[model samples]
Target: MTLRPLLDPQLIYLEPAVRAYARGREILARFPQARQVEIDSHWRNPELYRAAAAAEDWLKLKRDVLVLGVKKGMTLRPNGRSADFIAPSSSNGCAMACSYCYVPRRKGYANPVSVFVNVDDIVRSLERHAARLGPKTEPNTVDPAAWVYDLGENGDLSVDATISRNVEDLVAAFRAIPNAKASFATKWVNRDLLAYEPQGRTRVRFSLMPAEMAKVVDIRTSPMAERIAAVNDFVAAGYEVHVNFSPVIVHEGWEAEWRRLFQEIDDVLTPAAKAQLKCEVIMLTHNEALHDVNLAWHPKGEDELWRPDLQERKVSEGGMVNLRYKVAWKRRWLDQLLGWMAQTMPYCTVRYAF
Candidate 1:
């Protein structure tokens, strides 16, 4: 998540309403060189990514290609993975260059963030959905207090917060609603979030891995140490802080790296932070298409990610064919990691692991 403040982006394409909205105008002004273009809509357009370009070039140019439009679709989708529901998108893409990211799979060439300006409508939609639930009657693993809504399903809110106010706006909206809470995970550390007093309604999951693994794939994101270091401050900021040991890569020396990572996490946590911390373990889910994209500039990651002998093709709930480590392999890895957590990081709660 690269949220460079003063560096102006080179280009921006704005749709009709987007060119008029306050948020769009704010973003345009930040990038002095950005040019506004008229697009019919952000989601339906195919020429942006399909027509022409190299995947490697996109790694550098995608950050410069910003799309401003309204999110016309307001219906929230059921998501049992982390949150109860996936909130309407605050943003569609990320600025980071993580090679294994699935967001790049569908975008053939261009894959920059499509920042929606109509946040009010998005919030209203969430309001409507939460009203129907009528205060958690049935309890589930997601939460016992209120229904959880994911605000950053498609984009990193930490990076989006720097370029837009939608992240905080959603947090504020969820804070006021008695029946809901906002949740999102981040690979970047946004110091700006410390200003918001969310009343413990916003849960920030800090995604982590060993420094060596991050150095290989999690490109342009905040350093692993910085992410862990922010844990204390984030908890102090009235946010439910959680750890997401995500995209856990399997490689030659992964066990040693994970051992060191767990030890480091144990070393850094105070009783205050550790008492509040919960974790979600996500094993690496790799796609063949993304592997091809990573080979263009970041082949080193694919060397470890694309292991056919250990992996098998499976269609996701979204129906995009993807690869994951075979069942036996995943079980073994998850058991090993969870065992490590039990011994070294006993204070942390493993909410879910896969």
Candidate 2:
């Protein structure tokens, strides 16, 4: 068996001068055969460029293609509950084949890591944005000392770190700014990242699910044991290690599954990690399109995830259809999980549960 890099992009594309940059060169060195592609714009009129890649190769393209270009739009939007502000995107798409991931919805059949090479612009955006907020005058669950910026909303930096210095440079950028902390969630464990001292200016939230459910859906991501075990190590290093009980999947024997999962955390978590442990609980919200997509690539997972009777349809502002547990089922389910959490992991504080 071949040991693949945490992020193994079979083909890499850099936009002219973007390949000459330090971080760009770092990424190129890791994948020697990565070829460069030329496009007049990073975000527009690139259909001809994309048409070169075959539709049958979508999943392979998702896990394999890497685009390095400028992030021209530097606007930061308000992301209140998750973070003080949504930091300008560092990258888009992920390599992991998590069947339940929402990223594939927007990308249709093809989804791949698009690494932004204009890192200095991204850092500058964060610096300017953080400066405008000044001090966080009020209290919020996101962070008490520093305004939190969600850095990896669309991609996994843990996997991204293996391919480029984009994640590292962003973490370093956040570390220098006193008024904000860089926050991102990951399903993979990159222990090499511990070397970067966040200086209490970054938060690494490990997204989790029971091992049984994850094995069915998480695809090539790090093992649940690896993620749980890394918490103590990350805390021992300068990073604030947090847990994300995210995209919570409810199915047969869910209670027993969750109980065992929480108990495992309770058993292995070091005291230092426990003391600072804060969590954000997000319930699973599935979508019809994503369910259909999963059916094609990972049908086994869809058997557990696509439960029509338990879910209710929701229409987002973008006119996309999403499904969450019906209100009645959700109320009962949340109460049940909360009880289990309290009983199994008393030391952890749930900053927010939704």
Candidate 3:
């Protein structure tokens, strides 16, 4: 694969508290050419936040800005389906601009990748948390042998690996944890992570969609074909690989397109990958705030996302008003998609669906 810079920030927002950290110093040395601004707090950088919204091009701002801070609070929350718990974020935001991304909603106008420098602290806390949970006493769909942790709850670890050692550190930390596994969903195909040597301690869920839909919705992330092609290789590299059919967009002809996508996966995956493959199927859920944001930066992409006729209003657990496919319709669409998957890739297991 041809080498390309994973990140090229024109401006670096530095949190003074983190500059003394080894990780922070390494990042500064890596990007000496970029303009650096000292900020009081990573989350409270109003100037950068406003600039992100006011910028003429949203995607450009995402590519040009970076935030570095120390994650002071290390709390792992319960997560039943994707993992046993949502691990403390090693990072937040993402370089990729997927249209339906929820990360940007909380940050208002801007959502550039935020790298947390206190990774050693985060890892130590995770070890303590895992020790408290002890070994798994019951088998569940998430993992039969260990408690699972979603290490990239708010960001893409594969993309984060490009700019920081957090992914490497977290994966390495999990290797020694006897009863816990780290997992994250990502759209990027970063071969650098193949050297992390997870030894089945990390689960990398490659988020996927139909090729045509992905071309518009995934935005700046790896092409659908590349993600599919990398699955067997990642599995070979000792990481458990899973597929995520996330934010499954509902539209006319979506089923036929999905069928083609399933066929492509069945044709490309090696027997080894197919044997271990498990999937999480999540239908599209859109927020009004995100819809308004997309209109500013990527209006055309919204055409595939902001469909209200087939959707109904939803109040998210966080109390945000959102839109999702009505229950009856979503069930029907899910059933149809799963039926096709069973026929095309019977070996693949559906770990969870929503």
Number of the top lDDT candidate: 3
lDDT values for all models: 0.83, 0.81, 0.90
Residues 227-293, model 3: lDDT tens digits: 9999999999999999999989988898899999999999999998998999999999999888887
| Backbone clashes under 3 angstroms, per model | 0, 0, 0
lDDT per residue (tens digit) for residues 25-101 in model 1: 77778777777667887875666675225665665565667778888888789987689999988787778878788
TM-score result, candidate 3? 0.97
In model 1, pairs of residues that clash are none
Candidate number with the higher lDDT (1 or 3): 3
| Cα RMSD (angstroms) for every candidate in the order listed | 2.4, 2.3, 1.6
Greater TM-score among 1 and 2 belongs to: 1
List clashing residue pairs in candidate 3: none
Per-residue lDDT of model 2, residues 250-294, tens digit only: 888988889999999999999899999988888888888777766
Worst 10 residues of 1 by lDDT: 3-12
